[model samples]
Target: MTRDEIFKGLNEVFQDVFDDSTLEVEEETTANDVDGWDSFAHITLIVSVEKKFGVKFSMGQVSSMKNVGTMASILLEKLA
Candidate 1:
């Protein structure tokens, strides 16, 4: 999927995981930018994104991502 498409879906996952319907994610958005984005929430977000995209992220990939943009790039690469 294109980056825009991935971001659209990723936004939904983030909002859902955070229980905030109004949450909007930009390329630079990170856990620190969102309230309630603790470690448990991070795992939930990862699992939700994986299920939504039908993609599995390696531990390294998950740990290495710094922001939404990086996650979108990885998703695009895996989907490709």
Candidate 2:
């Protein structure tokens, strides 16, 4: 899938996870930068993304996704 298409799903995940429509995401966005983002929430977000994209994540890979850019790249690679 194209990055923009993937990003649309990403944006939905962000909106649902953050509960804020105004929050803008960038490649630099990380869990540390967002309030209310914790390990539990991260898993929920991952599950949502996996559902949206129909992909699965290994524990090691899930443990390694550190930021939005990394997540996007990984998702792209997986979908590719």
Candidate 3:
């Protein structure tokens, strides 16, 4: 899938996880950039993302993801 498609899916996951339909995330977005995005929410987001995209992320992959951009890149690689 294209980056636009990835971002579109990510947007939906983020919005659902955060319960804010208006939420929008950029390449640089991180947990600190959003309210209520603690460790718990991060796990939920990861699982939700995997489910949305039909891909799995390793613990290393999860820990290494610095921001939304990194997550998208990883997804791109997995999907590829």
Candidate 4:
């Protein structure tokens, strides 16, 4: 999927996970950028993203992710 496509789905996941229908996430988005995105929420976000995209992220991948852009890149690599 294209980056735009990935972001489209990711946006949906973020909005749902954060319980904010109007939430829009960009490549630079990180936990600090979103309210209520603490550690627990991070785990939930990761699981939700995996389920949404049908992909699993390694612990390294999860820990190393710097931003939504990195996650999108990883998703692209895995999907490819």
Candidate 5:
């Protein structure tokens, strides 16, 4: 899928997990910017992304995902 499609899928997962449709997700967005996005939700988000994208995030990569832009960049490499 394209980057927009990938981000769209992630947005859906975000809305579902966060239980808030108003939460807009952008490449530069960060967990710190969003309320209720703790570690548990973070893992769930990672798993959901893996399932959606059919890819696995290395443990180091997972630990390094600080913001949505970083994630989008990594996803780009993984999907590429």
Candidate 6:
């Protein structure tokens, strides 16, 4: 899938996980950009994304991600 498609789906996951429908995610979005995005929430977000996209992320992939863009890039690679 394309990055835009990934972002579209990923945004839905973030909105659902955060319980904020108004949340708009972009490439540079980070945990600090959203409230309640702590370590635990990060894990939840990761799992939710994995399930939503039917993809599993390794520990390194999860930990190395610096922003939504990087995650989307990784997702694109995995989906390819």
**Clashes by residue pair, model 1:** none
How would you encode candidate 1's per-residue C-alpha lDDT over 1-80 as one tens digit per residue?
78889989998998899889999999999889999999999999999999999999999999988998999989999999
Per-model TM-score versus the true fold: 0.96, 0.90, 0.98, 0.97, 0.88, 0.97
Query: What TM-score should be assigned to candidate 1?
Result: 0.96
- lDDT, candidate 6, equals 0.95
What candidate 3 gets wrong by more than 4 Å, as runs, is none
Each model's lDDT = 0.92, 0.87, 0.97, 0.96, 0.86, 0.95
Q: Write model 3 residue lDDT over 1-80, tens digit each, in one string.
A: 99999999999999999999999999999999999999999999999999999999999999999999999999999998
Poorest 10 consecutive residues by lDDT, candidate 3? 50-59
TM-score of structure candidate 3: 0.98
Local accuracy of candidate 2 as per-residue lDDT tens digits, 1-80: 89888887898888988898877677889988888889898989999889988999888879888898889989999999
Give me the runs in candidate 4 sitting further than 4 Å from their true place.
none
Q: What tens-digit string does per-residue lDDT give for candidate 5 at 11-54?
A: 88888889999777998788888898988989999998888778
Best by TM-score: 3
Identify the superior model by lDDT, candidate 4 or candidate 5.
Answer: 4
Of the candidates shown, which would achieve the greatest lDDT relative to the real structure? 3
Q: Which runs of model 5 end up more than 4 angstroms from their true locations? A: none
Backbone clashes in model 4, listed as residue pairs: none
Ranking 4 against 5 by TM-score, winner: 4
Candidate 2 off by > 4 Å: none
Which 10-residue window of candidate 1 scores lowest in summed lDDT?
1-10
